[model samples]
Target: MFFAVALLLPAMAAADPLVGVWKTEPDRKNLISHIKITACGDKFCGKILSAYDATGKEVQTPNIGKKLFWDVSSEGSGKYGGGEFWVPLIDVDAVPQMTLQGDTLKVKGCEHVLCAHQTWSRLQS
Candidate 1:
């Protein structure tokens, strides 16, 4: 029926290879989050989808709909850069460079002279 089809449309939607949900590696506090990346005009932007504490339990936070990164420009050879990532835990905006390889995404960010990196996996349907 039309109602059922409409309800299923979102679930059936195919995710773009570069634009989908990603699960971030655990932070220093062992907190993990799900981020959804989407195309914003000619660039890519990401927002926090959900958060999980160290105990693998969902936790509500003020950053639920906050931007994780923005203005991400893609380079050839599966590399992405030229964006700023808002590090929620440390409350800093760092320049982000990302590389996409298969279902794994490698993300590195720098704020001033300090840098950090994390490997994220694509969220499976």
Candidate 2:
């Protein structure tokens, strides 16, 4: 029983869409951060590849080299739970409930009841 279940785990976990670089809507002035996502253990994590300030100048932030998700184990079926997301735009932290749909990664959460949703596209390898 253990062996069978273990064999299935990898296949299921590998389906997450948050496994590549995601370019934000460049036309939308409000979105200017490009994210590159990869796997850490059984969880998915992302980092800011290009961060632009309001004036469109690249600025360095502490979280730039940080792990966006740590100890975030997979839940199942292209869904991941129990992960924290740090958005550079808001400069705040929030718990993320992320789902992988096709080539899109959807994340929704709130910071102190102020909710926000972000959709990221998967970059081609």
Candidate 3:
């Protein structure tokens, strides 16, 4: 099992193309979160590594280092589906889907039938 799992790690990493740090669009309060998206087996997950105020100054808050979303499965063709994202500001959960194009990612989710969408840019370094 160990050998088989080890052999599959490289393939798993290559399976998902949308793996990297992403800068989320500003929320209603004009705060942006830097989310690190990584591969989790066949799925993907993103966690907040840091946040910035509207002025681009890094802010230290309880939301830092929190899991933004997880279990995002690939739907092929630069699209992913079936993930749950937590909005710390409102303390609400929503089902999320994402579509990636170049360095931009379009994230969409719905909470209680209210849908929200945002565009996140890929972060280098």
- Comparing 1 with 2 on lDDT, the higher-scoring candidate is 1
lDDT of 2 by residue, 1-125 (tens): 99888776655545555567775544234535667776665566777777566667876656566655544556878787677877555668778777878888787766778867877777653
Which lDDT tens digits does candidate 1 get at residues 34-117? Answer: 999987756788999999998889998898999999988778688988979998889999999999999999999999999999
Segments in model 1 whose C-alpha atoms lie over 4 Å from true places: 1-16
Q: In order, what is each prediction's RMSD in angstroms? A: 7.4, 4.0, 2.6
Q: Candidate 3 on 69-114: residue-level lDDT in tens?
A: 9888888798888979887878888999899998999999889889
TM-score of every model versus the real structure: 0.83, 0.66, 0.87
Model 2 pairs whose backbones collide:
none
Q: Specify the poorest-scoring 10-residue window by lDDT in model 3.
A: 9-18
C-alpha lDDT score of every prediction, in listed order: 0.86, 0.66, 0.86
TM-score of candidate 3 relative to the true fold:
0.87
Candidate 1 lDDT trough over 10 residues, lowest sum: 7-16
**Greater-lDDT candidate between 1 and 3:** 3
With candidate 2 superimposed using the best TM-score fit, by how many Å does residue 119's alpha carbon deviate from the native?
1.2
